[model samples]
Target chain A: MIELNHVTKTYPGASQPAVDSVSLTIPEGEICVFIGPSGCGKTTLMRLTNRLIPITSGSISVDGKDIMGLDPIELRRHIGYAIQQVGLFPHMTVRDNIATVPKLLGWARTKIDARVDELLTLVNLEPGTFRDRYPRQLSGGQAQRVGVARAMAADPPIMLMDEPFGAIDPINREVLQDEFLRIQDKLKKTIIFVTHDINEAIKMGQRIALLKEGRLIQTGLPDELLNRPADEFVKSFVGADRVLKRLNLLKVRDAMMTNPVHCRSEDSSEKVLEQMVKNDLAFLIVTDRDQRLLGYVNQYDLRGHKGHAGDVARKLTLTVSPERNLKEALSQMLSYDLGILVVVGEDGRIQGVLNSTTLCSLVGSTYDEHGGHWGRITAAGRIL
Target chain B: MTTYDFIVRNWPELMSLAWQHTVFVSIALAIAIATGVPLGVYLTFNRRLADTVLYLAGIMMTVPSVALFGLMIPVLSVFGHGIGTVPAVIALVLYSQLPILRSTYAAIRSVDPAIIEAGLGIGMTRAQVLFKVQIPMSLGVIFSGVRVAVVMSIGIGAIAAYIGAGGLGQYIFNGITQTYDAMINAGAVAVSAMAILADFMFGRLERTLVSKGLRRD
Candidate 1:
């Protein structure tokens, strides 16, 4: 864990501190995102943790040891750091950049070579394709990946990332974020991430610490801040879409209804229609014996049918994975004008169903769980 | 007599003068690089002295080379090193500093701050950052500076013959006094050939020495 106790940093001649007396703790294996407007000292706070800039007062400790007592060079080698610029050395090949810390630690030639290849694989870059290529040869997204790979060169237990994906295009940023999250799950390195983007904080952070004018305003889980902002500053910072943003943190499985009324593909159309009628439903899902989704049969399609339900079943063009976020599912539903969506597992087996009503109730219950009194009052007001 | 005949007749003498010329410029350029590069690097750390020192080197360059050689004669006489090769070399060394120093200073300063920050952030000590990051990145620019100095020194070294330093310049000065057009032609042609050769060699050296990562082509 990295702990900051009343840590403050005042520039030599500045009137106020860049990072005021802020106290926070980033527990091990969690990404604590520091987010605020520019000049809010979010970046300064990250620098202080690595001793990139000296603190004016207070103390910082890493894993129960004071960082000040450790040699800065020794400290840095053990703590990986990546920045917005992706400041890759232009003179070195990608392999060399990633090998920097290992070489510094005096690892043998074969070991460093293997480590470089291993890290390249971890970052999804082919060693044969990228090892000899220079930084200039890479696109912005690739360079950032290499930058991240280089930081993790020595497998440091902690990492400081300042908007690592900030320079990437939106589509690419989401991809890198998901891939990084997948990697973080496996590595479980303690991380302190900095970004001015709230959406990124929601997506990347396990806990979000919001800052304002060099002071810590609130630090909590992403859902916590979205459901209950500490003040107007944070509310506005999280934007008016907090309700929708909160959905991004939830998976389709979290709100899915299990044991949905579905008919096997070989079932008679009459039998399928009877089942749909029994459930008071307008449509019936057709599945194989293994419960794999084949399609759906609607009442209109079954009106004059006298064959197997599979004969008239139309393919469900839009389907979401159980692991996908609700926000994506919501958008998928809206774009397709779907009132209901089928959730499937990796093998295409129908796991459950998510409908609009169930999604809304999940949102409303999330509001209630977080003591979102205003949200509930508004919901009640709307109902009335 | 034809210039070719003049060259063949005086081939041994010409080779000796050419060898002497190469030695004088090579030694002077070596001294200049040894002193100037360090000064330029130091100024990067001490910005207060940079403008003053660079301005001084710039002023030193404005003085005509022939006049600088004359000025060096009396100054060095005080140190018991008056005239000839010593004075010629002293003048050449001073003349060479501007390009070498300015290039080193500019190259080092132009290195991206982000790259330096990355180096330090990655746990390299200050010296390691300078030697490994700063120096390697600045090399192409620094070498270009050295190239300019080399070409400039070759041209200036010829004028050193006015102070009794032997070179192809010996042929030109002797030809001027004796009114021998062939000797002057031979001297002028040989000196121009030497300068071109030096420039081409340095170009090849730059390709060999500079990091392939830095090359555009």
Candidate 2:
């Protein structure tokens, strides 16, 4: 457990403290992220966790012991750290760099080699391809991964990361973040991750502590924090566009328009139109035995066909998973040149329809005053 | 018609003397690096003593090469020392300090604090972090300084022949006294070659080692 008991820090020239007298406890195995706007002390708090910057007043403790009293080197040994600007030694190869910590502890050559190999695998690096390579031989993301492997080498229970993924490209950042989250689950290490992006915190953090100008403004789970932000700063920092971010998190079942008007591919246009009109929907999803969307039919497509609904329903060109990121649904609609998308289960059963209006509405309501309080169904069926 | 032909005809003599000049420079540089790099490292770490150290190095830098020899004469006279390769090599060594010191200071100071924290955080002691992390990271810059030092050492090594420090400088100084242009030209060209060779060798070493981790593959 990591605890900050009224910790505060003031730089020589700055008038105010970087970290105010605020207390917080991060339980073991929980990924607690500190997030805020620029210069909001989120970075300062992470710096304090590792004693990178000295605190002007108050104390921080690890596992109920005063961190200041402990030998700084010994304390750091059990706390892994990585930063946005990865500073892998330019002269050392990937293998030697990862083994740096183990070497310091005077581990045997064989032990360090084994640990380096283990870290290379853990960080998803190909040992054969990357081990003998120097820092210059690796790309930005690869170097950062090496940084993580080096940090985790000592297997420190507490990990402090300051905007670790901030330097990578968007696609790479997403890939790395997902991989890192997976690693965290297995390690169960208490992590104090710092970031300026709320969406990242929500996606990766088990709990989040939001700070503003050196003060702790709010701290809660993603759902709790989103539903009810503590104050204006919290609301604004999480921002009004959060619903778009939430779309990535929400299950298709939660956002899907269930009981979609259904028709068989062999159904005639006239009959499909009747069902579409009855359901007040222009489109009817055509399904097979397993409810797979073989096709779809719009009321407009029903004008000429005179037989059963099955005769006119066109085959669906695309299908989506119920658990897929909702953004895919929006993209699927645009890609298929259709006004709606079909949500399918793992068994290929059509779960429901995703209309453009609903997708737009889901992405737009991030402005809601109470977000994480989503347990209370609002008038729009939006979680408050 | 060409000096290259003249040198070829006098190849045996010129080659032997060129070997001597290389020896003179190598010894001088080894001494300078041994003394200068450590002093610079110490001065950089100790804030209070930095001004005094800089002032001392500054005074040494401003002392004219020839005047320094004259000044050392009396001191050596009292100590009863001979005036040959030792005194001349000592002068060249003193001249190589500024680049060595500046680079040593810059390389250490410029290392990112975060990388150092990561090293220590990984359980490395202060010494290990310095040698393993800080030093290697700064190798590019530090070696560049070493390159500069090597260039200056070779170039100045020719000057030591003034005090009978056996080297190529003797040819130049002797040629000047006798107004023999061949000796002066030969000495000047040989010194330039040494400087270029030293620079090229160190540059390649820097790229292979220090720069390997700095450049993205």
Candidate 3:
């Protein structure tokens, strides 16, 4: 675990401290993300952990050892670091660069080679394709992957990444972010990630520290932060789409309406009508044992069918993944002109149906009267 | 022997003398680059003295190379020297400083502050950030400055011929008074070739320095 006890940093000749007296405890193996607007000390706080800048007062320690007392090189060796530009050593080839920290620690040549190969595989890069190439040979996203691999070279328990994917194009950023998440799950390393993007913090951070103008605003898990922000600064910082960003964390299991009424394609229309009437639901969601949605049959589509509601069932365009973001579901609902979308598992098996009301209910109890920033919900269920 | 044959036979003599001018200019450029890069970097952290120091460099740059060489003669004479190649080298070095200093200062000053922030955020020391991040990123621009300095020093060193400092310029100056095209062409070709080679090498160095590729900033 990393702990900061009232640490502060003031650049020489600056009018104000860049980072004020702030205390924090980051648990081991948790992804702790620092987030805020520019000049808010989020970056400064991260810098202090690595002793990139000297503290004006107080102390910061990791794993019960004072970081300040450790040699900066010695301290950094134990911490993996990746930055926005990647800063891969241009003078070195990719294999040699990724093997940097291990070499520094005097690992055997074969051991370093094996470790480099493992890291490349871990970050989803083809070792054979990238090993001999220089950093210049890779694209922005590829370079960042190599950067992360280099950082993980010695298998440091603590990793510090500052906007590692920020410079990548949006599409590539999403790819790298997903890949990084999978790697993090497998590694379970203590990570401190810094970014100006609150969305990134929401999606990537196991815990987020929100800072503003050199002050610690709030630090909490993603859900707790949205459900109970410390103040107005955090609410606004969370942005108008805070509700949507929060939805990304909620699974279809958490948000879906379970035990939905079903009708089979072979069942008679009269049979489906009785079932819909008995269930008091507007539609009978049809599915096979595998739960692959054939279509949904509403009261209107059922009237003309000779067979059961399944025969007249209006084919659903597509199903959403159980892990898909709530905002995406809302978009699909509008695009398909349907009140509900079937939730599917990785194998396209229907988990449940999620309508507008069910999703909102699943998210949280409305506290609009408490006078929060999200005063309206015009974007379907989004409290914009 | 034909005129061309005689010249080609004596080519070693001409090139050997011209090689001294190349050595003289190369030394001057080395001194300028070594001194100028730090002065430029110091300007970044020591902002208060930036303009004043830069203005002094500008003044030094403004002096006519020939007049500056002449002025250096007495200074060198007092310092156990004479009106010869030493004065010429001092003048050429002064002429070379402006481009290196200007480019280094401009390139580093314009570097995206975001890149530096990212560097520090990831645990790199300030020295590491400057040398590893900032300096390397600014290299393409800095290479342009070094190119200017090298070319200027080499071209200007040819003026040392006036002080009787032996060089390729000797042939060209001699050819001018005596109307010998062979000598003038010889010096001009060597001078142009040196400039082209310096430009090409620095250009390639710029590409190698950018291992991370062109950053968004």
Candidate 4:
């Protein structure tokens, strides 16, 4: 665990401290994001943890040892760091860049080589194709991935990332974020992430610490900050549409209806229609005997059909994964003009159903708890 | 006689003079590189001092090579080495300092700060960052400076014969006194040839020494 007790840094001759008296603890295997507008000391706070910038006052301890007491060079080796510019050495190839920390720690040549290739693969870059290439040859997203790989080269227990994906375009940013989250799931390093983008903080941070003018305004889970902002500053910073932003934090599994009414494709249409009517469902999901999704039938298709439901069921063109965020599921529904989406597991088995009404109610319940009239109005409009 | 004919007739004499001239310039260059490159690197950590030292080096370049050689005679005579290889070499070394030092300073300073920051952030000591990142990145530019120094030294070393250093410049002085056009032509042609050859060879050396990753194409 990393702990900062009453940290304050006032650069020489500066009137205001870059980081005011702030205290925070980051537990092992969790990601805590520091977010605020530019010049809010989020970046400064992260730099102080690694001793990149000296702390004017207060103390920062990583893994229970004070940073100032440790040799700065040796301390930095065990703490991974990545930044927005990537800052890759143009003179080194991708392999050498990732092997920087390992080489510094004096690892064996063979071990360093194997570790370099392993990290390249972990970041989703093929070692064979990328290991020999220079940083200038890579696109922005590819460079950022290599930056992350290099930071994790020594497998340090702590990592400090300053807007690591801030330079990529929107589409690639989302892709990189998802890829990083997937990697983080397995590695579980205690990470201090700094960014100005709230959406990124919500997506990546397990706990979000909001800073303003070198002071932390609020610290809590993404949902807490969105649903119950600390003050008007946080409410405005998270934006007025925080209720919608909450959808980005929640997943299809969190809001999806489980055990949705379904039937065997080989069942008679009359029986399928009876099941749909009994469950008050407009459509019936058709599955094979093995529980693998085949297709789905609506009441309109079954009303006039006199054969097996499998013969008349339209192809299920749209489906969502239970692991996806609700915002994505909602977008897919809107894009396809779909009222509901079948949530499927990796094995192609139907897991749940996410419809407009379920999403509206899920958002609506939160509003009811907060007594938010605006949220209720918005949720009602979305349902219709 | 034509320049080519004079060169052929005195090929052995010409080769010996060229060899002596090469040695004279090589010694001076070795000393300059050893001292100047490090001095340049040192100056990078102190900007105010760098400006002063670079300005002084630039002023040294503006002095005429012959006049500088003339000044070295008086200075070296105190050590009983006036008007020969020692004084001639001292002048050439001083002349060679600007290019080598200036290039090393500029190239190393211009290395992307972000790259150095990353190097340090990833746990490299200051010395390691200098050797592994800064120096390698600066190699291409520093080499070009050395190439300039080599070519310039060859041209200036011919004039060193005036101080009795004994090189290709001997032919020029002797030919002028004896009014022998063939001897003068031979010396001038050899000097130019040596300079061109040094430049071409250093270009190839630069390609090999600098990392392939730094190459734009």
RMSD of 2: 5.6
Runs in model 4 deviating more than 4 A are A257-319, A341-353, A364-384
Runs in model 1 with CA error above 4 Å? A258-319, A344-352, A364-366, A370-384
- Model 3 superposed RMSD (Cα): 6.9
Ten-residue stretch with the least lDDT total in model 3 chain A: A375-384
Clashing pairs in 3: A267-A308, A268-A308, A269-A307
TM-score of chain A of each: 0.85, 0.83, 0.86, 0.83
- Tens digit of per-residue lDDT, candidate 1, span A1-384: 999999999999999899899999999999999999999999999988888888899999999999999999999889998999998988899999999989988899999999999999998899999999998899999999999999999999999999999999999999999899999999999999999999999999999999998999999999889988999999999999888888999999887776676888788887667656655668777888898999998988887789998899999868899999999999999998998899889998988888887788777644465323321111110000
Number of the top-ranking candidate, with TM-score as the measure: 1
Off by over 4 Å in 3: A10-18, A85-117, A131-138, A257-357, A364-384, B1-16, B19-57, B78-80, B83-155, B168-217
Give the root-mean-square deviation of each candidate in angstroms.
4.6, 5.6, 6.9, 4.5
Off by over 4 Å in 2: A256-319, A330-343, A349-384, B1-25, B47-59, B112-114, B154-158, B164-168, B179-211, B214-217
Model 3 earns a TM-score of 0.75
DockQ of each: 0.73, 0.47, 0.17, 0.69
Q: Which digits, one per residue and each the tens of the lDDT, describe model 1 over residues B40-158?
A: 88889999899998999899999988899889888888988777889988888898899999999999999988888888887888888898889888989999999899999988898
Interface RMSD of each: 0.7, 2.3, 4.3, 0.8
Give lDDT for model 1. Answer: 0.88
Q: For chain B alone, what TM-score does every candidate structure achieve against the true structure?
A: 0.97, 0.90, 0.88, 0.97
Q: After superposition, how far is residue A337 of candidate 4 from its true place, in Å?
A: 3.1
For each candidate, give its TM-score against the true structure.
Answer: 0.90, 0.80, 0.75, 0.89
Q: What docking grade does candidate 4 earn? A: medium
Q: What's the true lDDT of residue A172 in model 2?
A: 92
lDDT of model 3, residue A332: 83
